[model samples]
Target: MALHLFSSIRGHRNQINALSRVVARGEPGHAYLFEGPEGIGKDTVAQALLARLACLDAAPQAADACGACRSCAALLRGEHPDLVRLARDGATIKIDQVRSALGRLRFDPVLGRVKGLLVESADLLREEAANALLKTLEEPPSRTVFVLVSSKPQLLLETIRSRCQVLRFSDLSPDDVAALLVAEGVAPDAARVAAALAEGSMHRARSLCDPARMALNDEVARFALALGTAPPTDAAAWIEQIAERRATLAQAQGADSDNAEADEEPAARTGKTALTREDLQWLLDVLRAVLRDVVLCGTGIDAASLPHARHAAALHAMANRCDIGRIVAVVDACQQLEQRMGINPNPRLALSALLVEAGLRLRAT
Candidate 1:
């Protein structure tokens, strides 16, 4: 027998069991809100639930879909007539897309007993689109199920959220993430490192496995340590170095044409190349992780527990050099900078100020 879809997914056993029970009862709710952290398998679980609902051979109380069946084959081919998936076209799901999908859901199932509308990144639904979705959720059609998946569910309309049967998913444990990566042929050491930095997000873990990203992580660790010892006057110079490193990483990653266009657009309009908010945010995240490790080391945590265990010596030295209070102040500054990045037009300037502040805090101790 072929492997069932549910069996391939890792974590979220409680959510899966709840969904399975509903499937077994043959009375799945019309609308479901599957909300969770990104890359924790919410989408995968939603797809599996839909697959089981559509599987012709699925029996009463069956735990999962018959993976070898015709319906399962169609789903695997992305040709399932009864399933309609909606994702962001560019940035938001426009009214037109919602209208189009709603039109399809109005029809009867083409190949199965039920039709499924899986809306990925449902929070990206524009105002008009969300209103249109709200109407459908209020009075959903018979034999149709709607699964709205989002990492940021608070952005969803209250009416829409209230109408759906909400299911919350938690992040995967680091060991679970590492095990999954190892199953996918990642080396044990690399998988462990990626999992530690992933913060329970499998998506981030996979990205961290990229050779370029791994190298960047090392650079970030070194930069964070250097910042702790560097003078406030060097903040501007360090910011410039960060920009150069970002450019190198972008080049190595073969950034897609869309990102390339985005990068070019800003440069053309401003006549100066600046790090995008996303770039700065990623750097901040790395810095935050390093600061966290330093704090943990200072608190007498084991090296194995740190995210950057390979940099244990440096982290320990930094931890010993600066008290927890000073390191925490720097971490707080990094977080505040992250929160203000959206409104602050000059991210580089903000980052420089943060580093200078961090330098002052660390040097004084």
Candidate 2:
């Protein structure tokens, strides 16, 4: 299917309108930097703008592309010669890739009025590659447009950022995310749950829709409840169980299990599978949501208003056993741990520590 029109995108109305106005005026900028949280439709908006610019039958005041036009069809088939897409080769966009892409961007448009270049995850450009790209941005070709998409715009070189017209995108509301999921044929109940846990990321919400991820969420919810209600002495046992389950699930899904090299850290050489940083983060996110629900239950909020509404009974149990202050403390600790996760080398150990800390706080209350 063809890419959705700008009008069809869920959020970023302001950004879309801004781009539409620029296109309508026939003075679109040569380079744009779309910076925002991942999976929040920045790239989608960029593509929509490019489509509008390329459409042959689009009216002067049109807010979207003419989907039936030749240019639009070429885009739909991913055969548009005028559009060049550059993404990281593996870990970074190498100098060679940037050189080649720059060479392509120099060519005249085959069909569309303007040539287009899209650099996905633009922050992954290596130092030399970024310098090469900056040179192109400095002396951009006529009738050409460049869209650089990045979630970590701060990592991009300051000089590179200054040359482009930067557009910032914000997170989508849960309602908007759920609506989009429903439109994509997800069940309403599942969509609402996924959206609530997604933290404004459509990619995360979609992943949460998978049966395996949903099952993992259930386990996390149970673990959260256990932290509140289980005997303090049983904390270690339950934490270990959950950690083992997580490791097993990761293995079942073909996680990173290559034998460690001699120079690797001790944690890697243990020959035992463990939770990754991503796995720990996922656990923390679900735990935070459940804890938030517990706080809501304590404050007499309606069950339906809870993010984990289906776990309202367990949340209430947790809330009744623990006071608001302790629950809040646990939540704060989770947030801090998440913020520090980038430097932490051992995710399984981190998860254990978090669970133990949560148990102590909740048991004290």
Task: List runs of model 1 lying over 4 Å from the truth.
Answer: 1-4, 36-39, 90-111, 123-139, 151-162, 170-209, 226-233, 248-281, 298-300, 316-365
Top lDDT prediction, candidate number: 1
Which residue pairs show backbone clashes in model 2?
none
Task: List the RMSD of every prediction in angstroms.
Answer: 5.2, 5.0
lDDT of each: 0.80, 0.79
lDDT tens digits, residues 1-365, model 1?
11237767888889988988898888899999999888887888888888888888877778888766777888877788788889888878999999998898788887777898999989989999999999988888989999999988999999889999999999999888999999989877678778877888887788788787788778877878766564445766765676677667667665542321232334311104545666677778889888888999999998666667878888888888988888888888899889987777777788878877777777744
Top of the candidates by TM-score: 2
After superposition, candidate 2 runs with Cα above 4 Å error: 226-233, 254-281, 298-300, 316-365
TM-score of each: 0.71, 0.79
Model 2 lDDT tens row, 128-231: 99999999899999889999999889999999999999999999999989898899898776787799888888887886786766777877787787774556
The Cα error of candidate 2 at residue 240, in Å, is 1.2
